[model samples]
Target: MLVEYNYVIICSDRDFSLDLKFRLKKYEDLAFVSFAKDKTEGLFVILKHRPDIVFINLSKNAPEYFKMVVELRQYFHNLPIIIGISNDKQYVFKAIKNHFFDYWLLPYSEWDISKSLLHAKAQIPEKTEPKTLCLKSYRDFQYLNTDDILYLKSDNNTTCFTMKNSSEIIAYKTLKVFEKQLPEQFKRIHQSYILNTDCVSGINYGKNLCTIAFNNSQVPFSKSYIKNIDELKKKLAQSAIFANK
Candidate 1:
């Protein structure tokens, strides 16, 4: 899944917010961007967060809710998916006309919500990033499949590549040189370390460290690059559910 961190905005009251949060507690990927009580507040939150999905509460007002979302298209080049939440099916036609991605009942159904989320995730295209990396050192070019590489470590001017097969290759380039070249999956967690987000098995915030999935080798992350590490967590959590640990 080549998905970045997906921000979510929910427009509802305090009680609905709490219920929704509890139902989606297991999904480590989805981010609840902010609190929005209605269309007025939702529009502001949507602009600020640029959320990928917005849940509109139709409890108080249904027709106006649909109209507001249609008007939102003018604000964004690509408007986020608007999901309507209501007890009655009366707003179904309006939701369809307004182009809502999905609809939910007031008292949420775990199964229905799960299906909608998974369906939406599958709709997103993947494998858009370049999978192969070419390292050229004076016409001696080496091609590496990005999936086979686990992490990168910098030592002065040279960068070390740790492969999934436990082999290492030294490149005659600074970490900064390849930082921008690599795909989004490669995150610079520290000055000396850049790990593949896919290979991360554990993140210990208290210890200020992350460990690879297969090897369990620890990588130290500094406070300055903590946000990168935070984004990494969301990356790994993309498009899937896990059995409870």
Candidate 2:
């Protein structure tokens, strides 16, 4: 199903803004599309509309432009942002560092913008039920809150969801499938287990085991997956620093 989303373009160049607005109109799933000529007006539009996606044009010479993007990230954590630039390699690297969903070169084709829009759409959770995942088992469907899930274990072809309440739900899908559907908090620590990092209380690297707070289960991580644990630690540290800020 196509999800309807609102988006705003913050571009100083009027001609480029108009061209982008025109291209975006072709997507029937996009709605409440608006434009702003500068950061001041863009902030107002963003606060008023709370758009699902934001497209901002970045100038290589303008340090303030990059600062504005960083401020937006602080205000709207995890909101999908697309960067627009003109053949600037430096800006591309900065965009990637800031976790912009996608970037398009100036005078981009309809296909290029469309592809970025599709990617941004996929990153955004559905507004109606943003925090829930629907898992199918036989003819019945199970709705689960992403936060309530502690971890998932795969045995043969089946995957088991271990919830915060200590209840388990068996689904007929592989752990690989759930890895994609779950939010960023979920990570594959082992070939057979996908863990929710939020529920992780401790990690014993010597034992190759991590403890989950929800059920106090010691899930093992593979040697090849040790890098995932390192990355998770970095992510947690960054999150802490951001929270303090």
TM-score of each candidate structure, all chains considered together? 0.53, 0.48
| lDDT tens readout by residue for model 1, 78-130 | 67767778887888888888888898986678889989888766654442789
Q: Count the backbone clashes (under 3 Å) in each candidate.
A: 0, 0
| Residue-by-residue lDDT tens digits, candidate 2, 1-245 | 45688888887888877876777788999884688878778777887788888777785333555666667666776655555566555577777776777777756777887787777787777665358999876788879998999999998999998899999999888999988888777889999999998888778889999998867889999988888899877776775634331
> Which 10 successive residues of model 2 have the least lDDT summed?
236-245
* Best candidate according to lDDT: 1
Superposed model 1: Cα runs more than 4 Å off: 1-7, 125-245
Cα distance off (Å), candidate 1, residue 102: 1.2
